[model samples]
Target: MAMAADKPFTLLDRCPPSFEKTAQGVCKLHTRYDQYDSIQGVGVGGLTSSLPARRDGFTPEQIDLGRYLFFDPLLSVDSTHSCASCHQPDKGLSDGLARSVGVSGEEIPRSAPTLWNTAFLTSFFWDARAKTLEEQMLGPLYDAKEMGNNPVQLLASLNANQQYRSMFKQAYPAASDDITLDQIYTALTAFQTSLISLNSRYDQYAHGYHQALNQREIEGLNIFRSFVARCAECHQPPLFTNQQIAVIGTPEPEGMPLDIGAEKTYNAPKLKGGFKVPTLRNIEKTAPYMHSGRFDNLRDTVEFYTKGRGHAVPEGVEMNLHWHIWEPNLQDHELDLLVDFLKTLTDESFMPPVPKDVPSGLTPITHTVQTTTMINHSNSAPGKGE
Candidate 1:
């Protein structure tokens, strides 16, 4: 079970920046303003048809504070990794690695998923362990292989910092103390929920802008939606996800233990290899696909679905072949068209900028380098599973 599941952190109690406080101290959020002002608009046809219903109260101040916290390395035990370190904006909010390297410089078992359109998701993480974004925010921090910061110590560290204290005060004026774990989670969740990605060539086309997509892209769109490829069955448009978990039979890394993805939380044999269906909104930018990051590029990923590269299932494990709708018999040109359509989902405006400096005075982000010896060793050895 998650640590802070018992805490009360509802959207109504913590109002957004746009909210007006009543004389009786009741909070109400205003949704009248054009929230899409900052990002490019999708015009009409409601391209973001799958956008999850917005929560009532998120303040601009809270978002600002969360942004700082997300980029700050102080949240980590060793102060070497920040949320942005693994979810780099330049790399489409995902580290450009098959598997992520945690604070100890050890490889994490699974791929770091992109933060794009997470507000639409009912659950967070590949395993779907976190039900709310607030819960998800604290997950990596507590994970020993990830940030590895104890919740008590983490709160103490933040409370000691005058800058964070002031920011917290401004974000949550109702709070008696300078900072608390709930407030931290709230602020972080607010910022992450604000990350919406709807501006793309496909979006423009969907919104009645006929000329937005070219001839090939249009053909690709047809192929994606057609039964021949059936790409859109799971990767449905608007948000581009069916919001379900399935075992598509992706091959386990050689020598690694079987990763019982959703089963870790659900403990059901039927869900043994099931993983959450990630949004393909900015799919082109977030490369190294699948739960294991087994496929390196979009072409390979498309081919996997078409040709089914997944290994045979182990005893007692069932593969959800219903979700695997890609027709292996698709012509090569049709496959090219499918790839072209997927690329249309790339939206550059969705990328968040890395902060020049963080509150802790530590570097906001750092690149991990593998020595020649390490690379040679990896080449000679097989991978270990989670």
Candidate 2:
């Protein structure tokens, strides 16, 4: 069972430069979207929506303690895969694999979702199965094909380590002598909430810097929000997701049966093949797209939307595809423009320092993704498409 099944755990990850310590040792996060406060933020294009509730009653020590747990593979049953193993920083907090390989080297059903801005989310997982972030941790931490560790084994390992014992005590200065499962959930929740990303070129344009995006990109943004394409209906901006489940009829890899997404969660037939609309904040880096990682790149992913409604759905499946899925019939360059606009969302400003060593002395599975410099196209006039 997941630790603290009786309680709840909050989430965010890695204290970035935006994090600051108060005189009382509480951590405060400063974000760009602070200006957009109301439920319906009044902003450029009138496309921005209000963010959801976030948790942050955590100390810096707790955030730091969670950081160690995040990168250390000891959280796994056999001391192999760490949380970072699937969600790496370099790749926009995603593994960049079509589907993640579990601790047993077995291929899982879906790709790893990025952890950026997770603090603002009310739902967890592609199917929206878990209500809280702590509940979500149970999926990967103990799934036989995932981290493969149980609560008893997990507590035993952490309690056996003196450094961990000290760290937990420090993180929870008022807690008991030995480490408890609640503390583990708290620390992890603290760190996960710390992972924030809001400073992007699109953010600049959204803030009234018309020059932040070139002419083509601005048009692409228009198309994205346009009723015909209607990309923004679900992937609404500011956060780049409405955080609702949509049955988009995305197909699985060849020869694979349907994964029947949120239907199992709510037990509604109409919800079949539905998944949470993921954040497009750093969509450029987290490729092969979709929950099953069906598409390889942004161009392909965008192309899927234009290929007519339910075009990719396997035959004989009368799925309740989201109404947003339609035949937009966008052109080649339009597809490319959408990709350019998406690339403008890249922001790695909140990356936390990867711990060099953990208390367990286990080699951390630090998934390192190569960083590439994005072209500066801010305020550029309409020109030939790159």
Candidate 3:
């Protein structure tokens, strides 16, 4: 499942009627899709209208199967944690922790990134380590610190279970009696691609409902787009990300080794400390921020950028000069406005309800009862590091 060295990464090129290509070859989905317009008023378009097309002839049945698998702890070796454990739907598909707690009770090296709008991404993970969603899905399942499922054992477990067997067969009728790892990956990827987030106040404002934003929010939006802050440069419209990694010189967490981010994947020295730019579609819900989760609040994150923290590059790493372009002289009110603008990105409509029970019979990790119990237990501290 590794990405071929010669493979050229590309976004969706198929132009729908709602989108038109500019002279520069960039296709922009108009801010007036009928679907979004119905939700709000006129002028409510999606940020990116790039919906994922079915892969390998996948259908809704397979997506349902993937949804079950995503919540089932049976996918883990210990039957303690599931994909939903860290990527909780209520928490914007990211566990509300500085770093993720794995099945081994050890802290995963990086924060669990939000799965929102992943269907539009060319690369996966904080380091862009995975070239595709299938590759990204396999990384955690096989990681010793994460799900830690042995592939043979995992398949065997599924094969032995009559329920899973029936579900797999239904999901992949062509592969009846032979459920391969590739099918599992495809199903997981399909489920993730279904998690799209494009209904927010900002979306409404961008679309046509100009009154969707109040005076403060409108002022904040102006600040965000203005040259002074220029937040829109990397956090571009629609997807709110350029889908590229940059060395922003984020400091190494205390007592932790320096994470060279995308450099680890490409083996390129110049990419040290660079991480993928994440979408801001659900910024208010997905916190703490950045690759290391250094800032717990939006204000702190904005202040960090205003101070130009990346100006002093680390000893061995090259800095991405784009981080230095932010206007440092922003007043407190303007910063508040900026934070307010980001808050408008939150869209609770994207949150899916946790299934009451999973076929595995293991308590659903996303269940409120289980989550509350886990929070109360000292061993399951949210931010406890490995």
Candidate 4:
């Protein structure tokens, strides 16, 4: 999602309590926009304070409006696939599927990544195609394989709904008479940007709660920081991603289609294999890792890195996959530590509660089992306490 602008706004009562305070000297996981003033690194400048007034850089009305849009099926072509369809709350805000099914019921190519803490993302999309969350919002709606709806048609769909009409008024009083596409994008983006993830086991441990993570997990966290893995270079501490692109050269499955990695970087030709480095937070729950969802389990992911992405073999430099940082033999126990540490990144309370009025007065579109229910409305799932 897009980062909150440097501007300020009043707070909502329903903001996540855990993220309400800005603890100084707490080892910032991510920095502000000016923090990266040196050479164009990730930087943010909005509300980093713990005060509720600016914690999310969004007003209550905007968040409420965005929440409705997030769950609204009207954003889709068939009204069968809302944003929440693939990014389910129970599955760490991710669908936990290697390939997500689209409105047309065709399997999409990449995994549905978690929306939690996406506000800090420097780039959007698996390939880092879209620069801002606002641009990313345009992606699924138009992708033939995803929501499959034209932006104009989707706006008309929302405008036709009476409930949505009321929401637009509450969300944008100044622009109440005319709810344009820009307003829809802004509201939806605000809602998503509000979905921050913190208060995980690691957060407690970082705050000096010694018993937060077990011994094995602690050791694993150390391994993750070690140079052998050099994981922190990309998947850094705190937010767990440096917001930079890396070419891991993940092998494509036998029948999968090929992808070009930043070949569009220049008019020149480029290899079609690279993908963005996703955050490792809530890693244990958001499984089937990687851009193409090639690795099913955490074990395989650790093994991939331990083996230096297959590039660190002796003498045969080209044979080994990750030639940059390859250690010959990392113990199996060490790998276990890395995986255990990663589990501590899970934030159980990341999912927000569905507004009681989201579906009120609106005709609930009956759907099949293939269509996942609104996660915000489901009580059975964990981390749903509003």
Worst-scoring 10-residue span by lDDT in model 4 = 377-386
Score candidate 2 by TM-score against the native: 0.88
Model 2 stretches with alpha carbons more than 4 Å out: 1-16, 20-24, 38-49, 368-386
Candidate with more favorable, higher TM-score: 1 or 2? 2
- Candidate 4 residue-wise lDDT, 7-98, digit = tens: 23222434343333234211112323223223221222111212111224555567667777776666778766677777776677777776
Could you list the CA RMSD of all candidates, in the order they appear? 7.6, 9.8, 9.9, 9.7
Better candidate number, 1 or 2, judged by lDDT: 2
| lDDT assessment of candidate 3 | 0.68
Best by lDDT: 2
The top-ranked prediction according to TM-score is: 2
Against the true structure, candidate 4 has what lDDT?
Answer: 0.61
Candidate 2 per-residue lDDT over residues 1-386, each given as its tens digit = 12212222232333447776777767777665666656642332354455566777678778888898998877989887889988888888888887676665655677889999888888888888887778788788888767889999999988887677777877777889788888888888888998888879888888788889999899889888787788888887778888899999998876456878889889999999999999998888899899878999888899989888898888888899888788889999999989989998988876887876677777667773222423222322111000
Off by over 4 Å in 3: 1-57, 309-320, 323-327, 367-386
Superposed model 4: Cα runs more than 4 Å off: 1-56, 265-272, 308-325, 355-386
lDDT of 1 by residue, 1-386 (tens): 11212222222234334446555443434432233332221322133343445543467667667788888878888777788777878778888877776665566667888887676678878878878887777668877657778888888778877666767877788888758888888888877766767768887787678799999989988877766676666676666776777777777656555677887678876777788878887888777888768788888777767674344466566655544543467777877888898899898674555666666666676454332322221332111211
lDDT of 3 by residue, 1-386 (tens): 11112322121233322334556443344433333322211122234333332222236555567777898888888777788888888888888887776766666567888887676788888888777888777778877767888899788767666666667777677785877888888878766766756778888877678898999999988887776776766676666776777777766556566676777779887777788878888899989988767789999888767775564456665654445355467888999999999999887674555756666666678621122213222232222111
Whole-model lDDT per candidate: 0.68, 0.78, 0.68, 0.61
Provide backbone clash counts, one per model: 5, 10, 3, 14
